[model samples]
Target: MLYEKLLAPLLFRLDAETAHNGALGLLRRANSRPWLQALLAGRDRAPEPRLEQTLCGMRFRNPIGLAAGFDKNGIAAPALAALGFGFITVGSVTPRDGQPGNPRPRLFRDVPNRALWNRLGFNNRGADTLAGVLERQPGLPVPLGISLGKALQTPIDDAFGDYAYSLEKLHPYADFFEICISSPNTLNLRELQEGSRLDNLLTGLVKKADDLARSAGMARRKPLWPKFAPDMPPILRDIALTKCRELLDPAIDAVVMGNTTIDPAFNPDPAKGGYSGPPLFPKARDQVRGAAARLEGRLPLVGNGGIFDGGDAYTMMKESGCPLVQLHSALPYRGPMIARRMVEELLQAMDRNGVRHVSEITISQPSRSSK
Candidate 1:
């Protein structure tokens, strides 16, 4: 209440990116100091055993995760984990280091809609630096998922090499690998999401992951999930799913339902960036449910976009058949405590329905005859 009524107003006064960086800086400092982190960690960091979920062959303390864009460089991940997210996904880390990304003012705050428009273009310190950062932590409090993307200048033909290189360097450090082919900011990035191109990309990636896993002596291969864009046409989405089932290796795990959307409807302004937060929830839910129906329980889905509160999260899981859901934009509006609030709300919903595990909330899959 204090943050919404007072501190948020002060923070909102700064440019979107400035405020974000400032908050991140504070979080980084707090995280660096064990005493400060513990002082701030309080109840938001507590665990609800009932909300624990097993997905992609790993146990998530809870289903709410900090989405990829939130920590593009893997900086402050330990701090974010201390804030109570069940897991933390860091980096859309590219093959090379120190990519400047899109020009500044790349992030905008849509106050009325409780949303954000970002054209960050996978900006980060790159995979090698990220590996070093992760190495420093050595033991993260939560399961860590790494999101991989090609450099903006990397041509579509050479994209496989970019992705493969990053995966090879970082595979030993991640619990799962998310191939990001969405993000409307990069030039022709969405083109990689096309059926044939995506298949080629994943085929190469899966093989690379297998090689890395063997050399690393890892017991099992890390889960590989492709991050998708929510705005894909129905036909394309179905085709994409078919390609997923056909091309993805059996060792590949689940699919992340989406990244930010480029739909103009969500951003009434003329800005050319992806829209996230509340405006994205409806379309994202529809896509999640659609994917669930098509997948028919064969694969688990991670629901994302516009998840602000527990009801929103619960509804997303129920209607979309997602066992786990993620939030990015919500954190800015609702504050760092958002994850704990969401978990509490989701647990309440679970209690109302007499369910224990998160997976019990299911949506019926459309039958083949109906389709």
Candidate 2:
């Protein structure tokens, strides 16, 4: 309540990126203290067993997760987990040897729409640093998904090597992996979503994942989920689905339906990057629904985008047929308590809809498909 009414407003007055860093810094500090953790935990609502879900071979205490791009370096994973998220996906970490990102003023707020636009360009401490962080941190209370991407200057042809390199470094640390082929800020990155390109990339990545798992003595690879864009054309989306079916190994677990939106309707500013928040909800739901239909339960989908409340979360679950859902923009607007609230709402929605399990609600309803 304090965050929504006061702290967030004051934070909003600052530059978006600056405020983001400040908030994260505070969370990191709070993470070091037992009392603060207890205090925050005390404020949270008791966990609801009905909200728990098992997806992609991992058990999520709740369906709600933190989307990628918030903790781009994996520095705050333990703290974010302590905040009551079922899971936390940190990083769109690049395989680059060094840290590189966009210039300042890369993030902007659309307050009325409760959205944000950013062209941060996969800024992080690089894959090696992220690996080290993961090694040093205490194991989280919930599952963790790591998002992978190519470096800014890496050519599209070389992007596969980049993604694979990051995977090699971070796979041991991730319960699931997200191949980010959809962020609009990277040059030609969206090409990975195209038919031939997507097929080639997944084929190579899947092979590498298998080799890594075998070498590590694991029975199989971790979940490999591709995070897509909401604005992908129907033909491109179809291509992506076909490629996922044909090229992805059985070890590949799910698809995260959406990274952010490149749609002009969401960002009228021609120069702005991908937009996210409430304005993105309807389109995101449509994409998830389409992917769910196309995949036909072959792969689980992680629904994300414009989820602001429990009703919004439930709508995404029912409409898209996604077993797991994630949140990002809402945290800033509603604070950590929002996670607890969302869980409550999701359970209530489940009861009202007569769905016995959260996974059952995903893609359960037939609607106008996007592709």
Candidate 3:
């Protein structure tokens, strides 16, 4: 209530990117003080044990996670985790150093829709700088995920090298890695999602991660997940699923559904930046349902896009069969407490539905002919 009634109005008045950076800066500073961290942590109680989940061999306190793009440079990760996300995804970091992103005015807000349109182009200080920061930061409250992406200057054919370099550099710090092949803002980046290209990329990166794990004396390869685009055609989504099921066991660990969309209908701009917010729920939900039905629980699905409240998260779990859900745009509009509120709502919905465990939530698959 405080955020929506007071903080949001004040924050919204600033230019979009400026507001975003300002909030992150405050958070980063706050996290440096013990009392501030304790105060923030005290606001939300722990989730009930029934919400506990183990996926890709890691135990998550709950299924709610902050999606990848929110903390793209690894700044303020522990502070973000203190907000109560079960896991925090930091970085869509590239191998190159200091990549300047798209021009200013790249971020626009659709106030009534509670949506964000952006073409920031994966701007970050690069993998080496992020690795240095991670080495010095305090232990996180939850699992930490690193999202690896191809460098903007890299050729389409040489994209794998960029991903491999970022992975190797950040491997020691990350609990898991999300191979980001789906962001719409990067040029020809989505082409990496093509069948053979995706396969080869995942296959090679998995090999690199395993080799690193062995040299570091770990038990198994670190978890590798792929983020997909919400705007994919049904056929492409199907192909992506088939490839994921065939690949998850050996080359991948889980799948995050999906990145922001490029649907032109959202605005009048010819640029059609990646769209994320309330309007994306329907499309994201359908993709989750379809992907879940296709995978048939073979690999876990982490649903992203358009989740503003606990009810939205519950629907994603029950109707779309996502075991875990992630939030991005909602954090800005609804505030940091969104994750705790979501878990609380999820538990209430579970009681109403007479379901006891997270695994018990599943929706019937629509007939194959519907595809």
Regions of candidate 2 where Cα sits further than 4 Å from its true position:
40-46, 249-252, 363-371
The TM-score between candidate 3 and the true structure equals: 0.94
Question: What's model 3's lDDT at 275?
Answer: 86
Candidate order by decreasing lDDT: 3, 1, 2
**Candidate 1 ranges with C-alpha deviation above 4 Å:** 38-41, 44-46, 249-252, 362-371
Instruction: Report the lDDT tens digits of candidate 3 across residue range 1-371.
Output: 77788899999999989999998887787667756755544475755799887677777888889999788888899888877888999989998584877888888888889988889999899999999999999888688999998777889889889999999999889998998999988899999888889889988987898899999999898989899988888899889888877666622388888778887754335374888888888888988888887777677788988888888888988986777888899888987667777788888988888999887884222222212
**Count of clashing residue pairs in every prediction:** 1, 2, 0
Q: List RMSD in Å for every model shown.
A: 2.9, 3.3, 3.5
Off by over 4 Å in 3: 38-42, 250-252, 265-272, 362-371
lDDT per residue as tens, model 1, 310-350: 88888988887777888999888987667777888988988
Which pairs of residues collide in model 2? 321-362, 321-363
Q: lDDT by residue for model 2 over 1-371, one digit each (tens)?
A: 66678778898899999999987887777666756755554465566677676556677888888999999988778778887888889988987453568887898988887788888888888899899989988888899989998888788988888989999998789998889988888888988888678888888888899999999999888778888888887777877886776655433467788877877876656376788889888888888888877877666678888898888888887876677788898887787567777777877888888988775666322222322
Please give the TM-score that candidate 1 achieves against the real structure.
Answer: 0.94
lDDT, model 3, position 291: 80
What is each predicted model's overall lDDT from 0 to 1? 0.81, 0.80, 0.82
Measured with C-alpha atoms, the lDDT of residue 360 in candidate 3 is 85
